[model samples]
Target: MALLVIAACQLMVVLDITIVNIALPHIQSALGFSTTGLAWVVNAYTLTFGGLLLLGGRAGDILGRRRVLVFGVLLFVFASLLGGLAQSSGQLLAARALQGVGGAIASPTALALISTTFGEGPARNRAFGVFAGVSAGGGAIGLLAGGMLVEWLNWRWVLFVNVPIGILIVLATPRWIRESPRHPGHFDLTGALTSTVGMVLLVYGFIRAAQEGWRDPYTLASFAAAVVVLSLFVLVERRSRQPITPLHMFADRNRAGTYGMMLSLSAAIFGMFFFLTLFVQDVLGFSPLAAGFAFLPVSALIAVGAGLASRLLPRFGPKPFLVAGAVLAAGGLGWLTLTDVHSTYAGSILGPMLVFSLGMGMEFVSLTLMALSNVPTRETGAASGLLNATQQVGGSLGLSILVTMFGTAGRSEARQQIPRFLAQATPAERLRFRRTGQLPAPWSDQVLTAGVSAAFVMAAVFTLVAALIAVLVIQVRPSDLARLQGGPDPGPV
Candidate 1:
């Protein structure tokens, strides 16, 4: 029952990430968002969630885990309601940020609860496997659900859907989940302030740079603020008693490598979803529901791979799976680059999508094991939060960076076709086209497809680097799994 509660909370959090993605086109049309700003719907949540995670973890300890969990879920439900009711972009973004605050508290606490609730060995392993599988499939599940909701009900249903789930979780949690006794510790306010503000500035800098040129004064200022603030965050962490994030957590080569792998994996995969949604709807002209179903295979393959990895991990260790998954993901992403305006779902998208899903699923299972395993129990919540932080920051940073690439490449492509398009337009049509500022049939479609393909090529590069890190840096061996089975502490890397 405890494990089920934790998994359900986690599934809800993870589901929000990609479920809104399929509805992005609809959201943009309804909300009047520019392409550059549309990403904020995703990034706003991630930024606050990632930035405050360290503090949220510590809060669970200082307060009680179950107490924090219930509060977080309630907050999430409220935020979801606000999002569903939102009429303006500002309202939606604010609601999303609030949702992140809830998720930040809930997600790490839920993971930590699993560690506290379940005994180590097969019991804990089984618990984590269930948690990991749910999380691994959540993104794909979100895509499908988002599609159906947008097609049948409307885009708002995506946010509205969470309210009921959250309400049920809140009601059931006290019945099933046990609360840990509170610990005595200071809140590390200075550290929290520095880290959260720094990350917000950093993410804003990336978003701004994508819209304005890198030389824009606002961009430079945002970047400068980020650097100065984050440096202060490190300084605060080093000097503070009971720091929100203990810097020593990264001293282990394997643990540090796992963090890096999580970041790279997130960067590659987040960008893939962003651009691919555009490809299917804007390029292939699939309806929202059909586009949702298009990604079903990827979700299934990921679930399969995650289940397989859970079974294999105790035998082969995390290293082989991590390396193999990365290689497979890179190959899949590379194949995605072959897509063009004429390509069909079956011809170009399906096979590569399967390959990507299989690889990511394997990586997800292995990565979770590597990141959370062998940590000191006292630091588990903090460690878990940091891992989740890496995923959020990496996604926001990578997507913002890739948005620049997409926008620039797309505009350049469209410019070449403008002269021909103008030649075919009548005087009145030319005036209308200019007034509306819309791209014509083939050129518009070609530009979007080109940008997405380019982004995928870069995503492949990121996954490949993740593979290199797994090969050369991580040192955890298959024998480590045995140490885990015996119920003694899994030795740190």
Candidate 2:
């Protein structure tokens, strides 16, 4: 029951990130959003969730996890209601930010619960397997759920569905979930506030650059604020007795490398989802439900990979799987770059996506185990929090850069192709193609394909970089993992 409660909460939190993605067009239409402005529907949640994750984890350590969990669930429910009721873009964005606050509090605490509750070794590994599997596959689940709701009911149902689930989790949690022993410490307000604000500025800077260009005054200001605030956060952490992040955690070379690798992996994953979702619906003219179902295979395979990797991790450690996973992921993205104007889902996407999804699942297990390995019990929340923070920030930044690339290529290709197309195309063909997004045969197809392929190439580059980092830096052996299985901190490998 306890595991169910925590896992359900984690699923809810993770799924929200992608669920709204499928509903984006509906939300945009309803809210009357400009193309660039619509991104905030996703960004607002991730920015705050990533930024405040450290603080949320620290709170779990200071306050009991159960108490924090209840509060977080309640907050998430309230925010969902607000989001469902939102009538304007600003209102929805605000609600999304509030949802992030709730998620930041709940997610790491839920992960930390696994370490504290299950005795390490196979049992703990099994528990982590469940947690990571759900976490990893939740996005796909969201796609299906969002598609159903948006297609059969209304777009607001995507947000509204959370209310019932959140309420039930809140009521059920105290029955089976044991609270962690609260640590006595002052909240590192300076460290927490600075770090949160710094990340927000940095992510916002990337977002601003995507729409307004790097030279925009607002984009420049955002970057400046990110730098100054992040510097101050480091200085404050160095001095604070009860730091939210124990800087010394980075002392482990393997852990540090895993974090960086996770960052790169997330960048590719997030960008793929954002762009592909658009390609399926906007370009291919699939309904929302069809779009959701298209991704079902990838999601199901990822769950399988995560489960298998979790079982194998206890015996083989993370290195082999991480290497293999990175290779497969890079290969998949590389294949994705072959997507053309005439490419079909089965011909170009499904085969490569299967390879990528499996790799992604293994990568999730490897990264989660690597991040949490050898940490003291008290710091589990801290470790989990850092792992998640990188995920959000990496996704946000990667999307910004990739979207900019996609927009630039798309505009350039359209300009060149459309003029030439008009010269040859029948007037009826031009009018029909423009009105319905129908391509004028070969030329039109090639142009859009060029744009989408550029984005995939960049995503492939990020994954390839991750594979290289894993090979060069992460060195934990199977034996090293065995030592840290059950008891005291074995210190850094």
Candidate 3:
């Protein structure tokens, strides 16, 4: 029952990442969003969630995990209501950013709760496996749910659906979950503000540079602000007694390597979902529901890989699974680059998606185990928060990089194809193209495919780097294996 509550919270938080993705087209049409601006619908949530995760974790430590969890869920529900009722693009983006704040609070606390609830060994391993599976598969599940809501009702339902689930979790949490002992500490507001603001500026810089080129003044300014703010964050953390982010955690090579692997893998997966969702819907002409179902196999393969890895992890340790998963993920993304305008879903998308999902599933469990296996109980919230932070931050940054590539490639392809399209298109089609600067089918297909293919190529590079990190940096000593098996504490890393 405790695990169920934690998993539910995680699903709601993680699924929000991609659920809105499925509804993006409808939201764009309704809100009159620019092509590039639509990403903020996703980024607004991810950036706040990633940036404030450290603060959220610290809050749990000072308050109590259960108390913070309930507070976070309530905030998330309120934000969902606002998002559902939003009347403009700005309103919706603001609501999404609020939802991220709630998620940042709830997500790390939920993971920390797992440590408090379950004892170490097979029991804890099983709990982590379940949490990891939900985290791994939630994105596809969101797509399916978003499809049903958008097709049967409307896009607003995507945000509205969170209300009921959150209410139930908030009610159930106090009843089933016990609170962690509160430690007296300050909020670290300076550290939180500096880090969160820095990340926002960094992400904005990438997004702006993608749309307006690196020389854009706003992009340069954003990057400069990000550098200065982030440097201040490091300096502040070094001096603070109760820092939100414990810098010493990274001193462990194995843990640091796991964080790096997570960063790279997250970047690849986030880019894959964003681009492929667009490809299936716009290029393939699939209905919203069909596009959602297109990713069903991904959820399944991820489940299979997660289950397999969890069972095998105690035996072979995490390194082999990490290496294998990273390689498979890279291979899958590489295969996706074969997608073309004429390609069919089964021939071009499904096989690679299966391979990629399995690899991702395998990596998630191994990463989770590696991240939390030997951490002290007092710092569980900070440790878990760092892991979640890396995933979200990596996603935001990676998506921006991929979007830049996609836009550049897409524009170049569009320029070449437009003249031919103008000559061949019907008068009505030509008028629409001129009005919207968007080509109609067949012609637009090539442009979309070119951009999608380019994005996948870069995504493949990310996963490959993850694979190399696993091979070169992650080492599980026999003593580490003993700790994983519930042996006595190996003292601080």
TM-score of each: 0.92, 0.87, 0.91
Off by over 4 Å in 3: 1-7, 113-133, 171-180, 426-428, 477-480, 484-493
lDDT of 1 by residue, 4-113 (tens): 88999999999999888898988998999877688889888887788778778888888999999999889999999999999999999999999999998888788778
Clashes of 3: 0
Global CA lDDT computed for model 3:
0.88
Error of 3 at 246 (Å): 1.1
User: What TM-score, to 2 decimals, does candidate 2 have?
Assistant: 0.87
Cα deviation of 424, candidate 2, in Å: 8.1
Arrange candidates by lDDT, descending.
3, 1, 2
Query: What C-alpha lDDT do the candidate models reach, one value each?
Result: 0.85, 0.83, 0.88
lDDT of 3 at 274: 87
Candidate 2 lDDT trough over 10 residues, lowest sum = 484-493
lDDT tens digits by residue: candidate 2, 82-125: 99999999999999999999998998888888877888789888
Clashes of each: 1, 0, 0
Q: Stretches of candidate 2 above 4 Å error?
A: 112-133, 174-181, 307-317, 417-450, 484-493
